[model samples]
Target: MKFPKVQLALVQMRDAGSKTASIAAATTWIERAAAEGAQVICLQELFATCYPCQAEDHTMFDLAESIPGPTTDALAELARRLEVVIVCPMFEKRAAGVYHNTVAVLDADGTIAGIYRKMHIPDDPLYYEKFYFTPGDAGQPRASVGPDKPNGFNVISTRYAKLGVGICWDQWYPEAARLFALAGADILLYPTAIGWIDEEKEEFGAGQLDAWMTSMRAHAIANGIFVGAPNRVGIEGRVEFWGNSFIVSPRGEVIAKANSADDAIVTAECSLEEMDVVRTHWPFLRDRRVDAYGDLTRRFID
Candidate 1:
């Protein structure tokens, strides 16, 4: 099967307060990318507002909106006008007290294509995602050790490509990436907000960033698929986001990368042909012993 050679744009931007400013910035970036011939564009996570997970304030809930609400509507219109597929991540308010970290996909025709909720909610220091988001039930088990098993991966097909959307913390897990690849995703897209804590900046920031990039690159190599990460830039509260948004080829090469602290659009052209070529050369998928990996369902072997 032959797929089109798709051009992807990763919009790396700083947090903004008003929807107007964020949308404006996104418009400019999208226009720039479209002029450069990008067919698919993705923005950083929570691009419309500052990373609210920084501190738990009930008032932050006001930022949440429905799928077809103002933000998505505007993005869908822009996508149709530009004739590009747009992936917009939003803070979703499903109900009064229920919310999720969701990414809405707008097709080239300006229609709402699909929505993928963040399944992994991290509750680490400086990142309090679990306090606000209800981890997405991808119809899977919550615990690896339990009798219940996760359905593996959630896959979505866009007008341009078969995509797998995962949020910030989800980027750290190989299980998520592998499952997405196994489910037939041609591209793994991660809308992220990873950064350095004020105190950790001097001690381990560089190492942390290196590890992050290394992991994503490994995902591309292991899965034989293109991987793209659109991360936020600039400082917000106790965290200083390390932009460095990038696109990696199926060969695990960094084709395009943005600056660590700049708002820029990184574009890369991915050929589905390359994925097939790489996978054929390195048959990781063909060699997988699925029937012998039941221990992966456990949290820890010990």
Candidate 2:
């Protein structure tokens, strides 16, 4: 398979205190990236509002909005004008009491290409995602939504790339990464909002950041796919969001990365063709022991 070099862009910025302000800030960064030849752009997780799951407050749910809401509508228009593919991750109000951490993939023409609800929900201190989001289900892959297929995962196909979309916590799971790659996605994008809690920063900060990067990079190397992580920067409440947003190659090389302290538009040119060459040489996919992996479906082998 042949593909042209695509400019991948990550808008790494601080929470703008409000959704309107954040969107405006992101739009500026995106415009700058597009002017510099970015074809596909991504924002950090829940870019429209502040990271609200820090506490279990019921008011936080107010941040969740339905699809085609204000945020998506604005981004869709921007995407159409910019003629770029925009990966907009949001706090989705799926229904009255149901919500999700989802990414709406908007095509260059402003139409929604597809959406991938985040599959992994975490419930750790200062990061209580499970309280607000329902675990995403990729019901009956490739099947249309119906009684047979409750809520199937749709393949996000855009003009510049086929996206394997995941949210913050989802980035830590290898199964999700492999499934995305197997689904024929060329790049794995994790729109993130991970950071260090004030107390743990001095003790486990360095190792924490390294482990985060290594996990995603390992996913890229194992699946022979490109990976882009756009994490938020600056401080919010008790957590300091160490940005360091990055783009890694199929070979696990950090091709482009942002700083840990400021807002920036990090861009990298992905040689999509390199995936085929790398996969052919590595042959990990071709050598998978599918018949011997039935145990993987279980929670554990007790």
Candidate 3:
């Protein structure tokens, strides 16, 4: 089936200290993207505020807000006015003590379409996410299973296509991408805020960025689907986010790429027709031996 060509805009921005600055910067970028004929737009992870996971200070919890809070309300209105789908990532305070790294998908009509929480939480030097967010229960393929429930990925259908939303750490796992593809996702969207630490920038920065981009591209090629990664740029606290945001086509070719340290809107035209063509020629999904992969359920087979 020949699908309509969809234009996507990825907004890569510097970490703005306050929500006011962040919203203003995002609004400006969204207007620019609309003028360029973008139907779907995505912002970087934790775009509303600076990367708060840099430290485990309890005061950082003040940044968290309800899903339908002011940020989403404003973005929804913007989506309606522009007639575009907006993926807004925010620090979500789910309940009294529960919090999450969540992305809210606002439809063209300005309605809240769906929300996907970041299933994978990374606990590294500058990234102390485990101190703030509770790991999402979205049931990715690698999720630990309980005796009563089975784990599977979540694929949300939009007007344009079926979207599988994954945050930064989730993008590193091929299993996450493959499970989403198996669940019939046409595209995988990753909202990220990744960067180099103070000292590691000189030693491991280049390799880290390369691995990040290459992994996502490999996911696109392996799944025969489009992959979109919108990452933030600029220095925030001790970490400097490397802003190499890009969109990879079904054939694993980068159609659009942003700079490594700039606040720019990267647009890409995705052709869904290529998905059918590519998957037909390379039938990896068809040859999968599901019965032989039971070992995947274990953390590590010794």
Candidate 4:
């Protein structure tokens, strides 16, 4: 269970106004990550398209594409050529009207490893995900309250590492991270598109970003696994997407971090031995109270 040292890369970039432009920009970044010796690379959520969930527009449904559609086809070729693991998030067109916010993991050989649909759909202001996406399977009733799917918190095994993929809102939930850790994921990758709504920037921006990062860092500390999050980095509409994408070690140490307002590629060398050391010292998983957490399934503990 010893993972070798891995050069993890987070491609943090701004949207280029159009899907074609965005894809091209991401392609360049991916190539850059590979050239810099990043064995595993993850792009921001919806890298092919700008953040379109700002408002519930019926036309936005056009953005959804099949899992093996054009985007993955292009990424697959790139992954094969570079021989690097790629984690790509896209708006999926499951059926006619059904869509899910999912990330398709491409193995180093360019094969589709698996897709993790966003389990927790947030419905807050400026982030109307429920309007467009259906939540992914959360296992039976007790494991999760979301709709059931055959793939529940799947951990994909690629040539480089076993990745537990999660989307933006999923990062806010500890259950998502714990499930991945327990399932033997070497690292947790969150492809996110979160930002500050223009109106709330002055008051809650700093706190919001701190909470977002703190939660993910806590996951790394608790699970004793690497955590890599690549976030969008520009103002699309009302929200200014905070870039600050980063990688953290098992002990919650910041390995590499991007600037808050810049398009950059952040890379860090993470040692698998560090994970074992941290987990041995702080054996939280070994002392979990699993038998007493049955009520976690209830809607409210009333």
Query: What is the per-residue lDDT of model 3 for residues 112-214, given as tens digits with 9 covering 90 to 100?
Result: 7777888889999999999999987743443443211223357755666677889999999999999889988888999999999989989998999999999
Question: Candidate 2, 133: how far from true, in Å?
Answer: 0.6
Instruction: State the lDDT at 31 in candidate 2.
Output: 93
Question: What lDDT tens digits, residue by residue, belong to model 4 across residues 126-208?
Answer: 89999999998655544332212327776778887888999989998998899999988988999889989888899999999
Q: Estimate TM-scores for all models.
A: 0.94, 0.96, 0.94, 0.95
- What are the lDDT figures for the candidates, one per model? 0.87, 0.89, 0.87, 0.88
TM-score of 4: 0.95
Tens-place lDDT per residue, model 2, 130-236, is 89999776655454743212233334778988888888988999988998899788899999998999989999999999999999999999999999999999899
User: Whole-model lDDT for model 3 versus the true structure?
Assistant: 0.87
Deviation from native of the Cα of residue 278 in model 3, angstroms? 0.6
Residue 157: error of model 3 in Å? 1.8
Q: Model 1 residue 125 lDDT? A: 84
Give the deviation of candidate 2 from the true structure as CA RMSD: 2.2
Instruction: Please list the residue runs of candidate 2 whose C-alpha ends up more than 4 Å from where it truly belongs after superposition.
Output: 1-3, 145-154
